[model samples]
Target: MPPSSALRRFFVCPSHRAFTLVELLAVIAIIAILAALLIPVAGAMRKKARETRCLSNLKNAGMAFFNYQAENRDRFPPACERSTGSWRAFDTLLGYTDATAELLHCPLDEIPRVRSLRPRSYAMNDPLWQRESWPGVSLNDMDNPSRTILLSEWFVDGNTTGSESYCDLGNPGTFAHANGTAGNVLWYDGHVSQLSSASHDTNQQYYNFR
Candidate 1:
């Protein structure tokens, strides 16, 4: 049998095992502080992720536009054009994929009801292209794809008059308030990007490259 001293040592906990209440509280307080510091960062990260996803949605929509153009002899949809009574162009592409909503919308929008139907956070600038002096102006005529605003978030109405009606070709930006400063924009070349508050003007300039 082991000695009594050995048995006692084996059963007894070390002094380190017993933390004081103050020490335990201090550790918990530090953890709480760390969590508080990370909460905003985590939220920002989540927002960025959502923005990336929205951009991907725009890319898909851009592809859908190209496909539609291919099928329709290079003719693009009207900026405010709908199938008699429907959402914007994004709705027309719903048959292709499920990410159509992200192309039309941002994660920061407040109107849940609006998003629930078409799930879009952005609109197309087809109306601006409609005013072109020549026929079949085409998206390629733009000086720079990065500077152009092909897709954006704008106000939706019961009558379906989109904000793109106010936009213009070669000058692709709008003062629409449907989405906040940190909104997603899809370029003409099927690429999506994020626009910042300081990047674009009140009208979201054409060549400003927001």
Candidate 2:
């Protein structure tokens, strides 16, 4: 071959190298492994973000609660009335505390499914309000406000018989976050913190009505 032609052919590169079947398969396998590893990490990061947002929402709700009490003679809001489904006393604080209704929602909550029934994510501690046998307690009634849980993330279902629209934190099964193992609990003292399932199960007194 002419030197010039050889040089031109080499420079132009009429043909190209292609990946071998094994090499291609190996590349695909590597990609699959990387995706598998990254997927869980990404999911965990998203969950953490949602948890942080939910905590912030709880903090806003806690402030609303305090603001409501400041105007209402140091009393907490009434629980949802089971008979007429009249009004969720907590919802009444929306205007009083300069809080929007959206602030009551946890980002992790299943919005579409529960929006019609329980539009908000946080719930009131039902035991804080007087019922038949349950004695109503005020914010002042709490001896250890720092240790008590005032509000938390709750899952509400209105389809069930005798179901109320509002979340009643009096239930032991009530969760604070999406994991169902831990919750973002708002204390009467206006501090919000994460309460693990283990801690909640061990200490029922903090959640109970005084």
The candidate maximizing TM-score is: 2
What candidate 1 gets wrong by more than 4 Å, as runs, is: 1-17, 81-85, 98-103, 112-119, 128-137, 140-146, 156-179, 196-210
* Candidate 1 lDDT, 78-130, residue by residue in tens: 54323332444455566555553455555555454432244445555654345
Give lDDT tens digits, candidate 2, residues 45-97: 99889888888888877777677777777776676666644336665767666
Inter-residue clash pairs, candidate 2: 176-183
TM-score of each: 0.63, 0.66
Best candidate according to lDDT: 2
How far off is residue 3 in model 1, in Å?
5.0
| The 10-residue segment with the lowest total lDDT in model 1 | 167-176
